[model samples]
Target: MSAQLPEITFDEYLNEQLINSLNLQTNVIQNLAQYSRHISFQLVDIKNDVEILANRVIALHQQQQSQFLPPLQMFVQPSIPPSNSLCFFPPAMQVFPPLHKPFFSTTPDLPNKPVPFSFSTIEP
Candidate 1:
């Protein structure tokens, strides 16, 4: 004996399809909300990492500045000659002043200039 199925009206079929579509839409919305929340968390982590790196860079810059010496000032004597002197002295006596050895070396070793080279053939 074969079982007979009941016939559903067109309105009932359309209603079922609409309910399924609504359910699918609801699922998609939920998934999008979850993805948005995950992205926000990652952004927060990245922001924190950037802040840490910036602080380290600032510290390094300050350290480098401290290591370097301040600007040096040259000592200049007055241009006026002594009352006992017979001749008038120049306005400036020394143009470049010498540096102390304790703080810095006066002479630093520098690389020598490169010499020109040429190829020549020799007889055996």
Candidate 2:
């Protein structure tokens, strides 16, 4: 003899489905939250490392500038003009044209004759 199964009502079925859906959504939200927290921690670490690197770069730049550059007083001091100096300025700059011919001019010219071409109708 075959055993008969009890009929499930539509309302009970719907409630069960809703619960499953809510459970799935809750798990997804929790996973996303955990992932976001992980990313945020990484970002925080990267920020701190970047800040330290930037500080080091600034210190190195300052040290190099101090080693290479002249004293600040020399730039600040005003120089006296010589009595024999002429108010003459240098001549204006001149622009020279390109030495070689353009690509289009270098290429051989096309023939004067019209190109022969025929269009055939495609049959279905």
Total clashing pairs for each candidate: 0, 0
Query: Tens digit of lDDT per residue, candidate 2, span 7-90?
Result: 899999999999999999999999999999999999888877766675565455445445644523322233455567786333
Residue by residue across 32-67, what tens digits does model 1's lDDT show?
A: 999999999998888777666755654554454455
Query: What are the RMSD figures for all models against the true structure?
Result: 21.5, 26.9
Which residue pairs clash within candidate 1?
Answer: none
Model 1 CA deviation exceeding 4 Å by range: 71-124
Residue pairs that clash (backbone atoms under 3 angstroms), model 2: none
Best by TM-score: 2
Off by over 4 Å in 2: 69-124
TM-scores of the candidates in the order shown? 0.54, 0.56
